[model samples]
Target: MRTEANRRKINRLYILGAGASYALTQGQTESLVAPLDIQFCQRIKDLQQRTRPKWVAAAARRVEKEYLHHVDFQITGLEELIRQQISDYEFIAAIHPRRTRGKRTKEEYLNDLNHLAAYLLSRARARDQSLLEKWLEKYLKGTEKRATRNRIITFNYDTLIDNVLLNWHSPQHVYFDNIWSSSTKSPTRLADRYPLLLKLHGSINWRCSEEEYAKLFNSAVTTDESKTTTYNTKDCHYIDKMWINNRVCTPEEQETPLIIPPLPQKPITSIAIFRYLWTYAYEYLYEARNIVIAGYSLPPEPPRVSRRLQLLREWSHEQVKQVFT
Candidate 1:
């Protein structure tokens, strides 16, 4: 039996950033994956060395020709250069006529960029003794002691947090846009459950129909076993393996994993799933009493993300009792 006082306690919201994922490396040089902004050229070069895909090679050449030609290496990183290219391409597309030949379109560039990012992130294997799991346990224990309600909002696309939560509790407890239930039972909305986890930037494991993207955002639960899809990061690895083995041959097979790349201006409002995530995040931030920001620098370059964070800070300023950064 729960007490009335417990139900009335303040909610705690945690904000995670790229640095949060990087910190999980625990100073291990071999297992560490470089952040978006660091080692921009080297990452591309390494990817080129690993794979012989024409698109990957073409993407590298484009990056070198367009960005590395004149920019100061000390000042701008890969992420910044990529953002600038995307922005410039967008501007050109909006004003001038679409060019069919000589250069790759903005969409093609973005596709290559996303594929490269996914490949890089997927290669990062967790160590035998996980430090992330231990850290999360202690963090959760402390948060539960002070707050009645707790939720996580992560900007990073990695599945480290997802792995921790799923391992800690039942699959139903960890909600990413979709709900989960046993094969015998119907799924339920994440809001119906306590302690929700929202991925703001999306995840590597998430995939949906490119043609029917909005359909993927539907919250209606399914009871039919055939229709019920298992939401696990490992499932993503399986899909990747199938693709590599030539088992995935059809167009539908190739476009299964739908991931949103790390860009300055994300199409959150345009996409149904992202829009819902942002709305959910805003609601939580507005009602939260404590906001714990860990390892997130809140970079000023990304307008969409920065604007939302600014609004969250403003909305929770009066109600928030404490802010831990």
Candidate 2:
């Protein structure tokens, strides 16, 4: 049987949503805050402009080449568009009639889906520095060593928190899911010693399937296990996991990074790593002394013609809150 001390090592858990990334630029000059779903349509329109951020222009070129007709890309509102497009492409492919006037082909629609994903990623990447660093400095009195009691689980795709916590040993010992194991290892010096920075909705810097990665970016595919762990179709690697200083595609001529895409139209249970990550989160939650949820809301949808006082609601009110150490 396990001792109580072993179970209590991880004392705090943080759950982050988009609002967390959005909060990063709360008081910066001309800093780009992470985009909420609604900002996408305008961002998409911005993609058409000749003068744009390097990352934006790079992703826009890809969209211009392979976008669907509706990538005529305008959603009067963003959240509704996110909900509509998040429906599985396979589902769209199955029901879409042949030669439909306005609809696109299966391949084309899939391309557009990825186009949106890439665009979202670029917006987050365009920021020069992470404001999260200062946020931490305000509370963290001094430099921390390798071991920490705090664990993080972020829903946003931005790497703000990743960049913040990734320096303990370069890739630092942060453990979320073992790319090598289907089962999560119990907390031990060899495997589970590091803080768990779980990216529940995947991350901006994670890449899966080397073959697919090469194919998407038109690179030469090689199975050189000498560099990376043996290629696994079932798992993903952080961009830095295999190579140093390489990013998944940047406008500054950075490498093309891969993401599992945000809250896809399909269930994430199909992905093995996601399964393990969520299980890890649940296990941590069960033993956590405190949980801090940084950013989430049920904010009102905007641009309504009526300027009347509307009730402000929250999705988590039906949930619970006890934020503290």
Candidate 3:
């Protein structure tokens, strides 16, 4: 149990990035579990030996041919490259025709791009589950008293945090923007708890119906269980298996993964859920007395995320006494 004085001093916030997960998964195997862009293409190729789909293999080849060889500048990762391509042709048709796009508009390619990226990320999460679970158990658990006061903001889309939290804390203790509450009781104030997690980039576990997506923009608190489902990354494999089997996908099966693609301009403004997440994050940042950034390099190109950090710095300039990286 935490004393009043200890609770008051627990205003620490942690910011996590891909490197945080990478560091945790290192040294256990010969192949890197969750790799950066430099190793992403090879990793996808390696995944091909297992159960990858034809479209995924084709996307891997495209990344190698168009991005790895042709591009002179330093590309961040495979997801960033795919996002750049999607943005470049945001309003125009592809220069070369695609067999898959025979009757579909160029805009439909965006879904294909996002699905490919999401698939790779999901596979990586599945591959590194053991090591990640160990790390979370050692660090995130056993410190429940401290956790209630500390806030976490993660840029990665993996559900590592969600998995650990669900096992360690009650559903009510962990708050996600999309997940419906299991109870109708009045919500407790977030400030009273220390280790609230905010996934700034979104999570793979999050799935919503079209109606819920529309409602997110109109309501302050969207909690309709019928319109949303939040399961672990492992559960999402059912949809992937449907794709692999080449079956007719249902609307529920085709629901979008809640990740915000790594675009130059993140879709925070256009997407209401993302906007709400940013607002929630700002509230935590405002009250943070110490900020510790782990494995997250403040990457420059993503304008919305970069801008959000800048705003946090300005908002908590006087309030934050210590910052550890």
Q: Candidate 3 — which residues are off by over 4 angstroms? A: 1-10, 30-32, 45-76, 90-107, 124-147, 181-195, 210-252, 300-305
lDDT (tens digit, per residue) of candidate 2 on 1-325: 1233444344666777677777665444322556666666666656656454455555555544433335445542443444445443445556874534465443333334444555455346423354456654443213434445667766666666665555533332453423311112222234443345766656656544444333432333342332322223233322322222224444333233344443224234334444445545555565556677767653454523211111111112222244542
Which one is best on TM-score? 1
Per-residue lDDT tens digits of candidate 3, residues 173-242?
A: 5544224332123334344333356778766555444344333333344332222222212211111110
Ranking by TM-score: 1, 3, 2
The C-alpha lDDT values of all candidates are 0.53, 0.46, 0.52
List residue ranges in candidate 1 displaced over 4 A: 1-10, 51-78, 90-102, 125-129, 138-148, 170-172, 177-195, 212-253, 262-264, 300-305
Quote model 1's TM-score.
0.67
Error of 3 at 224 (Å): 20
Total clashing pairs for each candidate:
1, 5, 7
Model 1 is weakest, by summed lDDT over 10 consecutive residues, at: 237-246
Q: Would you list the clashing residue pairs of candidate 3?
A: 147-195, 148-193, 148-194, 148-195, 149-194, 149-195, 150-194
Candidate 2 TM-score, C-alpha based? 0.61
Q: Any idea what lDDT model 2 has?
A: 0.46
